[model samples]
Target: MRVVVQRSKKASVTVDGEITGQINSGLVILVGVTHDDKEADAAYLSDKIANLRIFEDAAGKMNLSLLDVGGQILSVSQFTLYGDCRNGRRPSFIDAARPEQAIELYETFNRFLREKGIQVETGRFGAMMDVALTNDGPVTLIIDSKDKKA
Candidate 1:
């Protein structure tokens, strides 16, 4: 499992010109799953996302977690995160998990975050989406459960 976690002042997802999910002062999460991703991967990533501290504190140090800041999460399913571009000009999506399996794990990931007491919103599964955000601090991070394990 892989994720692009962007800290945002505001964010939203629109499908077919309709807003699906939006958040204020939170995160825009682009999630990806691979064939090897298991339920544990979701659990791992969600836990890290909830507890990882990037927000600033009183001294302007990045010491606040999302929970401390009362931030929400706008989770979006993004299989393209798995797109492999090293081989050729055209990216190969062979590393992406099948939709059915990916969706289940994706839901589990969201649920896990909620279970950690964070508010979460989500994009429609398997949809072409337009996501917009004001990236706070322009702070973005890539997290891989596979690498985190090591």
Candidate 2:
């Protein structure tokens, strides 16, 4: 499992011209699952994202966690994050999880975030989504569960 998180003023996901999920003053999480990913990956990433202290504090420092700010999460499953482009112009999704596996872990990740008391909105699993956001400070980071396993 891997995730790209961006602090956002507002964000939303649309599918087939219909808005499926939206959030304000929160984070937009683009999630990907590989074949090696498991339930524990979901738990680990969710916990990290919830506690990540990237938001500004009272001193205007980046010291507030998502929980501290009572922010929401717009979670979108994006297997394309695993697209590998080493050899050809066209990207390869060989590292991406099968749809069934990806969807399972994707939803599980959101469920874990919700369990942590943060509101979570999610786009339809396996759908082509249109995600838009006003990135705050463009605060973005990537986490890979495989590295944590070491």
Candidate 3:
């Protein structure tokens, strides 16, 4: 499991010209699952993201967690995160998990976030989505569950 986390002042996702999900003063997370990803991967990432102190404090220090500022989450499933372009002109998605497995883990990841008492909005999985956001601080980070050390 991998994720691209972006802190945002406001964000929204649109599908078929209709807004599907939206948030304010929160994080926009692009989630991706690989063939070997499991529920534990989802759990690890949810915990890490929720507690990541990327937001600023009263003294202008980056020391506030998402929970500290009561931020929301705009979660979007992105299979293309696994696209392999090492040797070809076209990106290969062979490393991405199948939809059946991907959606299950994706929902599990969102559920874990919601369980942490954070409001989570999500884009429709497997759909063509248009996402808009005002990136606060332009802060972005990539986290992969596989990077967790034993």
Give the candidate number with the greatest TM-score: 3
lDDT of 3: 0.98
Which stretches of model 2 miss by more than 4 angstroms? Answer: none
Give the whole-model CA lDDT for all candidates, comma-separated. Answer: 0.95, 0.94, 0.98
* Ranking of models by lDDT: 3, 1, 2
RMSD in order of candidates: 0.8, 1.0, 0.5
* Reference-based TM-score of each model: 0.98, 0.97, 0.99
Q: lDDT by residue for model 2 over 1-150, one digit each (tens)?
A: 989999999999999999999999999999999999999999999998999999999899999999999999999998999999998799999999999889989989999999999999989988888999999997999999887855
Q: Could you tell which candidate, 2 or 3, scores higher by TM-score?
A: 3
Clashes of each: 0, 0, 0
TM-score of 2: 0.97
- Check candidate 2 and list the clashing pairs: none
What TM-score does structure 1 among the candidates reach?
Answer: 0.98
* Candidate 1 residue-wise lDDT, 58-99, digit = tens: 999999999999999999999999999998699999999999
